[model samples]
Every structure is written in structure tokens, then in C-alpha cells.
Target: MAPAATSQKISEKDDLDATIKKLASLKPIGHSSYTGEIKSGYSGSWAEKLPETTKARYARHGVDISKGYPYVPEVDKIPKFVNEAYAIRNEVYPYVERGAKADPEKKALFGAAKEVINLTKHLGTEIVGLQLSDLNDQQKDELALLVAERVVVFFRDQDLSPQKQLELGHYWGQVEVHPQVPRISEEFNGVSVIWQDYYRAKYGLHLSFKKAIGGNAQWHTDLVHELQPAGITHLHNDAIPSVGGDTLWASGYAAYDKLSPAFQKFLDGKTAIYRSAHQYVDPENPLKGPKYVEREHPIVRTHPATGWKFLFVNRSMTVRIVGLEPEESKTILEYLFSVYEKNLDIQVRFNWRPTKEGLGTSAIWDNRASQHFAVWDHEGKENRHGTRVTSLAEIPFFDENSKSQREALGLSLD
Candidate 1:
């Protein structure tokens, strides 16, 4: 018609569509050769053969050659610190090792030692935090004791930047990125647990079919399935809604203390099964499997540094008692979970306040003595985002009573 309408050549859109169709016919990105960052640390030949430059730097920096130039503190100058930590750690080691019941005095002592040890080791600051470098020695010590005893500490008007947050976490140990996902920025490393709506569009995936975690508002510990779960998690509410998104943390130390002596004895040496069913695996992201697994850990674990014992299971990961009858396991699990759920006085709930800059704030928590839950009561309306940086430490263990005595200043568990 119109000038005999010369056969329209493939338009740019059509060309793109055709090319996309051809590409889609082939294998996806999973088939592509993308060698991302290598998994390292635990084992590697290079670790034994430290780089010449690294060795030279250590020599120049007056670092101890024997300890592989790790950040081992100056123990000679602060012998009391070591004695306190080791003493506490030793006091409860047998209880954990021998599966012996915890006496009321021992339980109280462990709780007390846990606080004192944490305070002593963390340069006398509470909650094992190093955010406020300006803290005086007394303030730091007070913070440590408070955090050790209470298990959770609160902050008001703490204006922390993401960069500062990540930097501060380094004082503890190497930061651990999410094991299976390639989502957050690499430079920030494992500092972020990023979430967003436009992410699906950016990644070119179905929106409604998959969802991000925390978006649902669930109560669980962060990455408990890992052999060494996070010692601490710094979660800042970068984005929050107008109202109704609060996070709560319960004290495991308190939970253990609240138990009757008979119950405490019954839990000694008994191990429970913890599973990894709650970790969010995006279906569209097929790099990892959605399969779940269960792990057996002590019902009561002694803090390796503090020698204090705390109840270890939370509702999210704990599946069952490893050797108990099915009915017994179910009954016990329900009871333990209820202990954490019902105890409100020993918990702290944080309300998110939308900042003027439009980013929400954050809270840092000790995963060792605390369990957390995100309140999903506010979804759809408020845009909440988070970036969490996890820290690695020794597998939580306990110490003997003699060791516990040497750790504190004549402070007994009773």
C-alpha cells in the first residue's frame, strides 16, 4: 500500500528479539565460564608458604613469627586478661565435655563469668563492640561487663556509616561473606545483605515467583547451619517503612539461667539437631541447591573465651534431639522454643526510625548469646534494606572451673 511498502527490514527491536531468541535457545549464564572468587582460608598451600613480602612485612612490623603473624594480643603485658578469659573458659569445659549436669551455683557462676570474661577480653567494652574508639578505659570495661551479663545492649542516636561498620567488624576477625550467593558488592565483601524490588528487573527475572528474606519478617539466627556461625552481625536498617518493622533479640544466657537444675542436668552432654531449612535460596538463582541439612551440636555450649554455658537451640534451625524418641524430641523442642519465645523481660526489641536521608539505622548483635527475629508486620508499603557483615571465631566451647576462677577478680558463679 503506502508506496508499495518496501519489505520492512528487521528493525532494531526485531533484531534484538531474534538475537535473544537464539541466545535463549542455548545454555544460560550457568553454562558460561565464570570463575568467581576462589573459596580460601581453611586450606591452601599458599597459606603455609607465606609470601616473601608478607613475611618481610611481618619482620619489619615486629610481628611474632611463631604465630604466623596473626593478631595475637600482647599477653605478657596484660596477663590478668588472659588468666581471666582462660579461667572462665576452663571452669565450664568439663560440664560441656563430660555431659555433667549444671548445679545452680555453677549455672549462676557461668552466667557471671561469661559477662566478666567478655568484658575483660573485649578491652573492657560491652557487647564485644569496638565502634566507639573514643571510649575511656572505664567506659569500655563497664560496657563489657554489662554486655557479658545482659547479652544484649542498646544504643541511642548511633550514627554509623556502612564503611565504618565494616571497618569496626575487622577488630574481631575476618569477615565472612555469604557462602552461596553472588549478590552483594565484592568490595564491601560480606558487609551487606542487600535487598530491593528493582533487583529482579535488573537481573531480568520473574518478580512474583521469588522473594528476598527478612522481607517476610521471620525470627531466626543468622547462618547457624555453618560450622562456625557468626559471632556478631551488624544490621543497619538502611530503609524502613513509616511504621511497624521492629526486630527483637532474646538472650540465650538468660534462657539457660531460667531453667531448673533438673532441666539443666538433663541437657548436659545431650546434643540436638540443627538444620539449614530457613536459609533463603532464590529459585531463579540456580548456582546453589535448595536442599536442607541437619547438624548435631551440644544442647549447652560453653563460650570458649568466657567459660559460661548458654542454651544453644533456637526455633529456626533446631530440628530434633539426635538420640531421643520422636515424641520426647518433639516435646522437648516445643518446650525449649517456648522458653525463648515466652521470656520477654530478657529480650530487647528495636523499632526502626526512617532517617531524613531516607536510609534506616542498624543494630549490632552478639550471635553467641542472642537470637533475633525480623518483624514482618510491615511489608509492601515500607522499603527496608539491610547489609550484614558476619565475623568468624573459634567454635564456641567451655572451660573448667579452675580456669574460670583465674579469669575473674574473685567473682564466683554463685
Candidate 2:
């Protein structure tokens, strides 16, 4: 006999249809509808466009570029608790001057930089500290979009209990707590993510000898095995010292563009598989990682909103080159990984400092394109704790025209 009719299933289909119909009728949202499409040979001006969520997302959170500027964070003024970078806007004058001073190609690069992020903050910007009690609907929405654009942003001076940190994680997107470890707080059922040595010792977990290989530090987007791995990650540090232990970030745009034109063409459409490296996870400690948890991503991954490309492979978790011989794969990977590692100027180093109250801080970042390395520099008797919230975004794609257009607009690989 055929399976019995399920009312629940029919109801779900109805809901799906209604949502699809609404989306089908929707037009592109935001200035991106025009600016984004312009690079694709779309000719209609802004007036011809219909309202769209993409546009709204841009409108609500986009850096106001009409005034001509670049975003520079008011690092000195913003309080420790908020993401000071949120208040960043571009300063275009110097850029324009620099462009005018340079040759034509360098001038083009300066133009492209203008389109990078919101560049105006004359009225002053606010850095809202996030806590379970303080996260209102508007702030959550703003935080989500801000994360999607900047890839990573930071928050300092938070007094987050382990439980509260997990709660904050939930607001960002799906929570992927490490399986082996118990939750950090019994009340919140929160799990803590340990980095370096001190974090492992805090919970009576001994350091695995396998870490001697220094395997975990390889670069990768977080949790690629899940249908939706987190695109944004929140790492809260609880037991930080006065100095040392800086995290480094590399911009994918610069990474991809830094490649020679011939090499760029080679990877234009190629894909590679990324997985958890067995060496990084102690084989004896199954909880830390599986022998292999695999997913495939473009070697030249693009930023969804900006349409810029990044060299996606990192030293940490990327496993093998698809369809290549073992020797060929090793050679190619070695070349690619070198490019990823060698380009340091496109990267940023974040130094950790504790607040007067002794509570440390945390940062949220997009895992899809940006690569990060946590510096294990602190050496003391004290234990340190860091919690992260990882959010998800759509998978990667490439648009060459977007890259050229971005360059024309004054965006720089630097």
C-alpha cells in the first residue's frame, strides 16, 4: 500500500508554496540591486528598481557613501563592551588624494577601496554591547548584517558568564557546541570552546600529545560539514592576561587578487574538499574531532555581497585537491597554502587586553571567507576561557566582473 497521507506534510508544502510565491514576486532590494547588477551589464538606473530586502539590508545598515568617505573606527572613543568597528566609516579624501597622486592602475585601486564599507560617521556611531538582557530585535538585525559585510567585528569588556555567552550565540544563528565537552554553565547548558593550552587545563582535560604537530592552527571556515556551518563566530575570552595572544585575520579579496593572472585563471572555476584533519584532533580523543568531516568549497571563493574573490584554502582543515593525483594535489596545495600564508599585509592582528574589572572580551567573525589564527602567546598559571557564536551564510561563488568593478571603484587588495 502507498504511504498514508499526512496532513502535517501537506500543511508544510502549503507554507512552502506561499513563501516561494512571495519571493518570486519580490524585486531586488537596496542600492545593491542597482550597483550590484550594474557590474553585470544591467542598465536601469535606481528609479527603475523595485524595493527588496537586499536593498533594505543595505539601506538600514549600509555605510553612507553618497557623501564620499571611508570608514575608520573611532577606536579611541568607543567603550570596551561594544564592537568599536561598527562605528567605522570610510575616509575618502585621503584616498582620492592618494589616487590622484598615483599612476592610473594604483588610482583605480584607490577608487575601488571607496566601495568597501560605509565611510561616514560625522554624526558619531554607537557601539551597542550585546548581552541576553540587552539584545533587542533591532540590534540583533543590525548585528547580523554588520557581520555579513565586515566578516569579523569585535566586542570588549563583557562580563559574560558561560551560560550567557551561549545565549548570545543562539541569537546569532544555530549553535554548534563541541560534542565531547560538557556545557560550560549548568544553568544555561552552555559549552565552552577551548583554545591553546590554558583552556584545556581549566576543565581537567590534559593536553593531547598530538597537538605537538601544531595542527589546529590551519586556516578554515568553521564547521563546513553541517549543511549550514556558522558564517559568524563569537569567541569570548574569560581568563586573558594583560598582554600576548593576538588573533590574526587575512582578507580573502587580497589573497585571491595577489595571485598572478595565470594562477588566478587556473583556479577560476576549480573546487577543493575541506575536512577536519585527523592530526589536529587527537585520535585517542574522539570528542575533539572526527577522523574526517568533509565538505567542498571553491578554491577562489567570492564574498556574496561585495562580489570580491578570496583564496579559500587554509593550512588548518583543507584536505585534498579534487580530481588531482596525490603528488599533483600535494604540489598544488603547497603552492596555494603558501599564498594564503605569505600575504600578511592584507591581514589584521588583534591584541587582547583585559578590562579593569578583570573580565576579558570576545569577537565575532564571518567564517565563510576570512581565515584566522589564534596566537598562543600567554604563559602563566592562570586559566583562560573563550566562547564563540558562529553564524551561517550561503556558500561561495565567483564573479570576475565584480572584482574588476570593485577595483575600478577604488577598492584595494591591501
Candidate 3:
């Protein structure tokens, strides 16, 4: 059955159509890349031509100039998606399921599941049976509520296609289109290709990791530099290794609870600055090196759907506490980051190795309430790839009356 056509979906077709588009930047990494042509969510410009000196500068920064940019000359009519990264006219989608039902919806959704297992005490929940592609509006609504409560929900053996996944993302909210990175294809604009190896090679990053820890390996949420940020980000790993290639997620609410009452109060209203993964060159100061897209968000934010406060800082993007001194902010942030990094019970590690081809696992996470890290333990021997769609939510805000996840659920620490 086709999704109902509402006033919102005027020009949208049933599921959406796509033509094969071979991106120059993506052809090098064949199997893991998405080559479908689709509509773009935002308008961004890439340099068609640059001086040799400028090209050398970016190449030195680790870009593979030989493969060329992920330029679709037929689609974009330009040379590259590299050189300078900046997005304009990106539409922010308002979240729909705010204050949606909490109890009966969850009951109905879970009752339909063959076996529903909580992956961890504080957060992750894995549901077996029921294809994600067949979920009705009500089920989708309930699933949204469940994700807000669980932090991250998992589904195995789903036969969902990229088109179906993109449709699901639209139903959830406005899907985020990352202009800086190469996604699954042009046809599925909002769906991003989650390939660590693609990124590692793109920037000439080292591919060696023997369970190494700290630094960028620390906890992170997606697209913090966006004005509204990301809400529920869904990832379906179409390809996985036989061993290793796991992802670990930690509950932000629990991280906040790990703090004392006094400490929590201190962080309750604090705000922080976050940087984007893609850096842009300042045209005025091209030789000064690239600059990151930075945005500000509250340190402790309350989710509109859950009515709970969660620690909103991640070590990767989150740089400083707005109102503190350099050393003071650094000192406080280290301790707060430790609360998330050190906690075992608040975290859930998921291994994405699938038994069958179509039975690959999908993880739907509430980016507003949790942080996650993809383990590089696979070491590039096996191909691990996934397509991701992130829905934009409301600009993060804090409400003094909002309770923590544990406090709201009556789940005691003792």
C-alpha cells in the first residue's frame, strides 16, 4: 500500500523514484557507495575549478584528489563536493511526535513483537520479528516513543530497502542531508552511507586499532552543529564483518544521573559550543587552514517527547562550557565526560554481524538522549557499511521542571 498523500507530500511520489548516478568521488569505493540519484534537501556549492596550489593544499590535508569529488556532473553540473564546505537554505523539519501517547501505544507495538529484549538495563532494546517496512502510522508513533524511552532500539532480520528506509525517515520527520559527505546516492539524498573505511581512506586516516580508546573514539551524537540538531537517527547495516564491528551507545540521562544533585544543578542550565565533522575553508583566510561549522546547544537539555533531562555534551563535538573560563571549562568537561565514559551499566554494545544477507541489523537511536561510538575493531579486513537517515528535531532547550530518565521512570540507583 502507498503512504497516504497529505498536503505535505504534494510533489512526493509513492516511495520516490531514482536513476543510477555514478558519482566521481564514490566510484573508487564501489560496493559500499550509494549511486542512486535523488533530490537534495539543501543547496550547497563545491568548487568546479581551483588553482594547483589550492588543490595541493587540500591534498596535503588528506583528500584524495585523484578520485575527484563526489561530483555528479550530470546532476549537479559541477566539478566537486570538496574544496570548501558550506550549506545554504537547509530546511529544518519540525518534529511531529512531540507529546504523542506513551502507554497504550508502547503496549500495542511491543505486543506485536515476537520477542522483545532489553539490550541493557538503562537503554538499548532489541525487537525480533515484524519488518520495519510494514509498520503502520500507529506502530511508527509507538516506536518513536519507545526510542525516546529506550535511547536506542534494534531490529534484526529486516528486509527493508533504501527507498523504504528513506520513506520511514520522512514519516519520522524531516531527514537531514549532509552536504559535506557522500551519501548512498543522489536519489536518496537524505540517506547517508555509513562506511568507516570510506571515510578513513577519504581523509588518509590510519586504519590501525587494537581496541584503542579515548579521543574521537569517545561518545558522540550526530549533527550537533545543525541549528535544530538530530533527533532519531536510524542506521541499517547492509554489510557487516564476520567478527568485530560493534557499536556502543551510552545513555545521556544516566550520565546526568551519575552526577550528584549539586553537580547536576550546576550543569542544569549550562550551554556549550559544538563543531561539525566537516570543516570549511574561510575564503578570506584560505591559507589559515579550514574552519569547522560550529553551533551552540544547551549542556543539559530536556527532550520534548520524553519530558526528561539528558546530559547533552559529547567529547568529540562539544568544545567548551559557554560561561566558564578556559581552564575551568576544560576541567569541568573532563569530569562530565568521564561520567559517561566510565559508566558500564548505562552503556550497550551491539555487534552488527548478521547471519544472512537480508537479515542485517538496524539500530534506531534517539540522538537527543544518547551518544554512540562505532568500534574500529574490524581493521578494514571485512566490508562494514550502513545507510543512515537522521531526522531533525526542535532546537534543544532546557526546562527546569523536566525530570531525569531514572527519576521519571522511578528506576532507582540503589
* Arranged by TM-score, best first: 3, 2, 1
Q: Each prediction's Cα RMSD?
A: 17.9, 19.7, 14.7
Q: What does candidate 1's lDDT look like per residue over 103-196, in tens digits?
A: 4233333333323222222211222223333344344334333444455454423345545557655644456654333322324556654443
Question: What TM-scores do the predictions have?
Answer: 0.56, 0.58, 0.77
Query: Which TM-score value belongs to model 3?
Result: 0.77
* Local accuracy by lDDT, each model: 0.49, 0.48, 0.70
The TM-score, computed over Cα atoms with residue i paired to residue i, of candidate 1 is 0.56
Choose the strongest candidate by lDDT.
Answer: 3
Query: Poorest 10 consecutive residues of model 2 by lDDT?
Result: 90-99
Highest TM-score: which candidate? 3
Q: Which stretches of candidate 2 lie over 4 Å from their true place?
A: 1-133, 161-164, 185-190, 198-220, 277-291, 395-409, 412-414
Q: Give candidate 3's total backbone clashes.
A: 6
Ranking by lDDT: 3, 1, 2
**lDDT per residue (tens digit) for residues 301-333 in model 3:** 998888889999888788899999999999999
